[model samples]
Target: MWIFRNKSFKSAYISIIISTLIFASLYALSNFNKIGLSFYDSTSSSLPTKPKIQEKSEWLTNFVDPLIGIKNGEVFPGPCLPFGVVKVGIDTNDAGYTVDEAVTGISRM
Candidate 1:
């Protein structure tokens, strides 16, 4: 097979195939209810509903910013949506490694 011709390519191809298969299986399993597989019986027909949003508190705010320290200050302290692809935050330092006096402009992570 073409995969056998190059050892590195073969390994990469196999890894890609395995990862794809794993992702596909997980995706199918997650959507089993919507796909009509019906893993459970009539008794479990009702799915759990989303939790109600409440007023934000100090405890909740500190939870996300768990990281601390000067070197570890790279952590973003801005609002970010759950499972968001782009992380919008401030870049404290520039390429020169000097910290900016003010947190200016949104940086995409």
Candidate 2:
């Protein structure tokens, strides 16, 4: 409040703040190389450094059926964790598939 009470003092205060910020930014940019910050390293080895992807076992889903409710079943079936609340499945109808209605395509719920 005191700084803004006088017009001259307010302009001088804002000018000082702006000049300080500019100086700080310029100083950081000028010393960027001395700071030892490297965006890319040309000396890195040519050996593959990519992370290994963990492959899921095919035997685990061998017995699981995702199309259980596509014909006559009354439930949307998909992979779900044990005791987990979230479930992913195809949402056909609110009451599920019946013998009369033909299922079109898979849809997410």
Candidate 3:
């Protein structure tokens, strides 16, 4: 056969054929129970309902300020959106930017 023409290809073809047969047999065996049972309900007959769209009151973006704590001696007050990764701010101190300290350079975190 063409399968046995090449030594490497022969083993690969045999393995593929054996695996395919094994998987096919397993699939057939798995579906045998469902086939035997006449009243088997695999899925619901009713159609799926659509989800309702909820209307939110308002967004709290007004309350959020990216440069809120820049003047205070706290964390980095870099401007970034909610759940945002990239932030742009003034590099001042080791901890973060302060009001008293002069602007050294810009940084991203």
Q: Compute each candidate's TM-score over C-alphas.
A: 0.35, 0.33, 0.31
Give the backbone clash total of model 2.
0
lDDT of 3 by residue, 4-99 (tens): 668998888889999999999999878887877533465866656688655454556656776665566465555776675777777765666567
Using TM-score as the measure, the top candidate is: 1
Candidate 2 local Cα displacement, residue 46, angstroms:
17
lDDT of 1 by residue, 1-109 (tens): 4538778988998999999999999998899888677866657747676887775674577576343433445644546788756666665446421243565565677
Clashing pairs in 3: none
> In angstroms, what RMSD does candidate 1 have relative to the true structure?
16.7
Candidate 3 segments whose C-alpha is farther than 4 A from its true place: 37-109
- Looking at candidate 3, the ten consecutive residues that score lowest on lDDT are 53-62
**Structure candidate 2, residue pairs in collision:** none
Score each candidate by Cα lDDT.
Answer: 0.66, 0.67, 0.71
User: In model 1, how many backbone clashes occur?
Assistant: 0
Candidate 1 TM-score over all chains jointly: 0.35
The sequence of per-residue lDDT tens digits that candidate 2 reaches over residues 13-109 is 8999999999999998888878898555768786468797656764567778766665655554566566645556544455674545556666444
